[model samples]
Target: MGRQYAVIGTGAIGGFYGACLQKAGLDVHFLLRRDYDYVKEHGLAISSTFGDFTLPQVNAYNQVENMPPCDVVLIALKTTQNHLLPHLLPPLLKPGTVVITLQNGLGVEPEIATIVGETAQVLGGLCFVCSNKIGLGQIHHLDYGQIQLGAYGNNHQPQGITPTMRQIAADFEQANIPIQLAENLLLARWKKLVWNIPYNGLSVVLDATTDAMMKDSYGYQLSEQLMREVIAGAAGYGLEIKESFIQKMLDYTMKMKPYRTSMKIDYDCHRPLEVEAMFGNPMRAAQAVGVAVPQITMLYQQLKFLDARNIAIGN
Candidate 1:
């Protein structure tokens, strides 16, 4: 049989990619939360700049135990909901199941290892897609759907490109999704953070879209500064991200569609911002290595306060 797949947390990221994998004629199951009933009745819809398609029917489940054990499990849940993993993972896992975490932030893979143990292999998938859940059972893919994947050892060290990594890459490539295999997982996370930190943080704090941020003078300069701080922090942690990446990401963002960040969207929807995963962990990592990132530290402090205030006020 072909690879059996399970997608937990079928929101924007999970729903979009899981739909793509299913469209590839693979046997894919989606374990949904809020959108479960709607998707179960009407199926999932993806509106993408590349093209638009709708699946009339999908193997959808409301609970993890209702799904069968699968060969690959794609976790697309928010890091905030990760406390449920110890309870959620046991039902859908089996021997030789490869768990791929498609969540944001650092230090995620090791956390999965602690729960899944040696029975299942875990990988980190850093998605560069900009998409959102516009409604129940709907995903809007704006631009960029490339994924960078890395292998994680039991101790969470980078194991370089392995056979399983290559196979998964081929599988994604077959589905017409761009895939990059990273020999170093930490470095890949740091590189993605170079873009995420500035864009996600500023979009919420300044209340602007990415294009608007790039167009304005203060926004442009501060974003550049934050990018530089990310580079410094990574280097201090012995994961040296190149200085050239800043300009590369800047140029890319300048040409992209005028878009709101995920964090900004979460804030608008009253969902809790991933303050700890995106900022807290990185700031603490830098401090552990005696690296001072004043700009990032300030952003972290501001975002933490804002997040707390939003949560306290029920928004």
Candidate 2:
């Protein structure tokens, strides 16, 4: 029998990738909240740079309990919602199931491991994609969509590529989404932070998209400095991220479409920003290692204030 996949969060990241897998003929069951009714009746619409397609019929469930146990489960919710995973994940687990967290920030896989326990394998999926849920059951993919998969190891050590990782990668590859296998999940998470820390935070604070940040002299320079601090933080943990990678990310952003980052979008909509996951956890980790990240610290504090105030007023 083929792998039965469960997508835990049917938002932008989960919906886009799950639809791709289903489009490739995989059995993908989606667990949704608000869009459950619309998607069940109208299916999913994906507008992407790769191409555009629609899933006229999908296996959609409003709750995880209604979904079947599967070989793989993809958790694509923002880190802010992860607290609910303890309640949302159990119903979708089977023996030997592999849970892949397609989330940003450090220390995510560990929390997932605690929830699923010893019966499942946990992996970290680093998504370098620019995607957003534009409307109910609609996701617009503007730019890159490659994922880096790595095995979670004890004490944050490298696990090397495992058989399970290869199997998951094969499924994503068959769906026409690019995949990179990382031997060190910790290193990959840190590398992703290099891009995320600067753009996601600055976009909200500066009230600008990536293009504007890259165009203006001050914005561009500030981004570079934050990137360096993130790199230094990684080094404090014995992970080496080269300085040249900073320019590579900057160049990539320069070429990307004028886009609002996920954090910025959340701020605009009065939805909770992932202040702790995307910013707090990383900044605290760096501090724990005796690395001072003044810029990241300030950014985290500012986002915290804004996120709290925005949500309070919205409520």
The prediction achieving the highest lDDT against the true structure is 2
Residue 141, candidate 1: alpha-carbon lDDT: 93
lDDT of 1 by residue, 1-315 (tens): 569989999998989988988888888999998888999999999999768999989999998989999989999999989999999998888999999999998878989989999889999999999899899999999888999999988545779899999888877887778899999998899888999999999998999999999999899999999999989988986888788889999999999889889999888877889888889888888888899988889998999888888877873
Candidate 2 lDDT score at position 16: 96
Model 1 misplaced stretches (Cα beyond 4 Å): 154-156
Once model 1 is optimally superposed onto the true structure by TM-score, how far is the C-alpha of residue 308 displaced, in angstroms? Answer: 1.9
Alpha-carbon runs more than 4 Å astray in model 2 = none
Model-by-model lDDT, in order? 0.90, 0.93
Q: For candidate 1, what is the total of clashing residue pairs?
A: 0
Q: Give per-model TM-scores.
A: 0.96, 0.97
